[model samples]
Target: MHSVDKWIEIAKECKYLPENDLKRLCDMVCELLLEESNVQPVSTPVTVCGDIHGQFYDLMELFRTGGQMPDTNYIFMGDFVDRGYYSLETFTLLLTLKAKWPDKIVLLRGNHESRQITQIYGFYDECQTKYGNANAWRYCCKVFDLLTVAAIIDECILCVHGGLSPDLKTIDQIRTIERAQEIPHKGAFCDILYSNPEEVDTWAEFPGEDGFWGAPKVVFQFVHINGLKLICRAHQLVHEGFKYMFDEKLVTIWSAPNYCYRCGNIATVIDFKDADNREAKLFKAVPDNERVIPSRTTTPYFL
Candidate 1:
């Protein structure tokens, strides 16, 4: 096994390691994640973060603002890669951290983690460009397939990348599904990583996509029947750092500051304490003045 410290150093610099080394790292981490259940259970006194979307510098800023690994028990609600310049760095850093401190961190699979989605978005191309081959990307996908779909905290809060699914009624149901595979087009697995709740009383799909429209009442019934106090998710981008709905029973937290580097939105992380207390720590996007953002001519095809 390679040293996790070395990978951490490479990640701190936001630099990609060699292809062979990255493949080794991915294989090692995949072995560990394969042993985890679909619904990973976590205890409280932990911090929950939202979509990262490959904003590496912002992620570094997040660690500085919200506390760092091993010291902070973190449950990252996915979207770790895609749509930013440093997908490889962002994901490998998180993967290295997981390998180093598996007990201190929980990595849930996001919609972008899938091969089909990444191919359409940016991760696959990013990998080909950065590594000169698709091997590293393939290895990472193996790890993605092993990631858990949801996490239950303190037996009261349900944490997932996306909102609740109509097909899901209990946390046990989340665990029963076989998780080590590609995310299906339409199913509990896909829903767990893509569903979002509608803000209005009247339900409507997102304007140009086959989207889901869920309500506060839907959230209430799901939590009530399952004996959950809250549902914390991060699939949708809330302009505000965080949003509370249904009288604070469900919350959507977004951690990617200045989403896509243009959304002009702030980010937040929720610290879930052991005694049922929740506190949100907010932060702004790191200024990108020093970075040269190129024009969209060479941008990924999905954009």
Candidate 2:
């Protein structure tokens, strides 16, 4: 393993790491993530963050407001790449921190982490552009496959990138899911990663794809079966940066402030303390300063 200082240096500058270093970092992190179950168990007094979406500056702003790794245990509900300008930098920093403090950081898989999604969104192109090749992108996808699907905080709050799955009624069912593969088109895995609670009933179905019913019923069964009190997720955008639905039985926390640099929405993170208290901290997108802006031309990636 490379020195922690080397990774920290790369993170500080948001520099494009060499291909070898990137591969090594991904390999190390993959080993750690592979050992974790689909329903990763975590303790309290940890801050739960939502979708990052490559908003590296906002992520830095998050650390500024919430504190850095090891100092504060963090559960990142994922979407660490795509849409924003610094997918490479944003994800690499989180991976480095996870590698450094494996027990301090919990990185879950978001819908955008998959190969098909990244290629359509921004991460794949960002990796290719940053390294002048696809090796870095490939390495990162391997790590993505290893990322956990969800986390149970204090055995009460279930943190997932998306909401409940019809096929999965219990935490043990979720554990039976075979991860480490590309996100499927349909089924419990894809549903948890892509389905939304609000749109479930009204969702249009394509061939071979199942229809999602509604948030309330699904969430109730999931929580009841797992013996959990709440479910936290982050696939939808909320104007206030967070939204409580189904009588606060489910919460959606979105950390990508001003999504796509145009949504004009706020971002938030929820801190869960040991005393069984949950506090939601709201923050805004970072100012359009030169330091935080991407140096390379980012037009092609979006196209």
Q: Kindly list the per-residue Cα lDDT of model 2 for residues 225-285, writing each as its tens digit.
A: 7788888989888999899887778889999888888889999999888626989999898
Full-model lDDT for every candidate: 0.84, 0.83
Off by over 4 Å in 2: 199-213, 295-297, 300-303
lDDT for each residue of candidate 1 in 48-130, tens digit (9 for 90 to 100): 99999988989988897789888889999999999987888999999989988988899999888999888878899988887
Shift in Å, residue 125, candidate 2: 1.2
Model 1 regions more than 4 Å off = 199-211, 289-297, 300-303
lDDT of candidate model 2 versus the reference: 0.83
Residue 6, model 2: lDDT of 87
Displacement of the residue 32 alpha carbon in candidate 2, Å:
0.7
Q: Number of clashes in model 1? A: 0
| Error of model 1, residue 49, in angstroms | 0.5
